[model samples]
Target: MSKEDTSLRFRQFEADDAPVVYSFCLQLIFKQSCWQLRKKTMLNRGWMISAVTASVLLAIGLSWPVTLITSLLCTYLLIWISHTAYSYYLRHNRYQDLCSTAAFVARWCSGGQDRLFVATLEDGTVIASSGIVHQDIDTCELVRVATEESYQRKGVGRALMKYVLRQSTSFGYKTVVLKTSDVQTEAQRLYETSGFSLSKIYTVGRGIMTVYYYKLNLTDH
Candidate 1:
């Protein structure tokens, strides 16, 4: 752990931590979703079309004010479209099902073989958390690896990951697998650095979302 994280402590998840954990997870999901939507919107072909149209208007000797107004209108339209699409997706997507309720989240890590570890400050504020659930006799699945935005890059997440992996090894698991979205670049980096290899890439939501699957062989570690 880095010096910044020296005051942090790790422990098993407790019932009272459900609310905080759920809220944090939900916020992270929303933040990621919004970022992906914004990126896609900016990269969308609609922007090129708008730019071409504006250039054509200018080439045809249209007034600068007219071209400027047209461009601004197009930009506003794109923003509106992006916001509307994001709202609709949030309402209908399975992301909500993952953390639909604090109770559900609590029960997810309540299984006998499931382990959820939380890293907290001296005041008990959870800054990071991760979980592992048995997948089979020889494998386990990692879930909910997240760190508060403000506390990232301070070794909190890496420390929590180490603890989770150690606990998985202690449980006699031979392998650990995890899934993360392609947009979660930081998480992918962390997993790769922690010895996880990319096992697969698949899309869901009719190709709207891309997910990466990773696995680490505990025996090798």
Candidate 2:
């Protein structure tokens, strides 16, 4: 597909789109979950919390002017460090059964929020895929948002996501939510720029992994 073809034709999925969609889903999930990315993001987030506390305590003994400067510096450092750390650690590996969090949309799309969509070229080559699941009457879940490895950052992923958000709004879901890993920084940007807010952060395996939840309000859409 032309990289400049910002108008990639999108439509509902078909039985034949299954294998390719599954391959893209797994590849992105596994590749982004690489330990190298996790280790890089985890660098000293635990330490920054301690540093922030220490700075506040250390300020107790200083002159007023110095104390003010120190507190500001500490707070700035804390926010900066924490943001960097989190930006790296929000990756998710939630793919489970056909109906799991990262459920393969091809075979698992059952209707409601589970409806799936795919992006294709005019010649019928599939290049991207995404889906939404209804968490409840008021909330929808986004999942399996993936693009061919070679197609990353060419505007395909963002198109698929915006499409999903529109679908969520159309289906009566007021909010759309999804979990993503810490290292998926680019994906997070897409979500945030699309009006999704960070709703919560969950850690499992005693901090071995951190998962982030993001939500987009579709009410005003």
> In terms of TM-score, which candidate is strongest?
1
lDDT of candidate 1 at residue 8, scale 0 to 100: 84
Candidate lDDT values, in order: 0.78, 0.70
Candidate 1, superposed: residue stretches over 4 Å from native? 1-4, 48-101, 204-208
Candidate 2 segments exceeding 4 Å error: 1-6, 35-94, 97-106, 109-113
Tens digits of lDDT, candidate 2, 1-221: 34447558888877667778877875776555454444443463544654565567666766656655665566556555554454345332234433323444434655544788898877888989888766889887888788998888888877777777777787788888898867778888878887888999998655656789997778765
lDDT: which candidate is best?
A: 1
Q: Which ten residues in a row have the lowest lDDT in candidate 2?
A: 91-100
Determine which window of 10 residues in candidate 1 has minimal summed lDDT.
91-100
The local distance difference test score of model 1 is: 0.78
Per-residue lDDT for 102-209 in model 1, tens only? 554655555678778899998989888898878999999998787877887778888889888989999999999998876788888999998999999998655555
**Model 1: colliding residue pairs:** none
TM-score of 1: 0.75
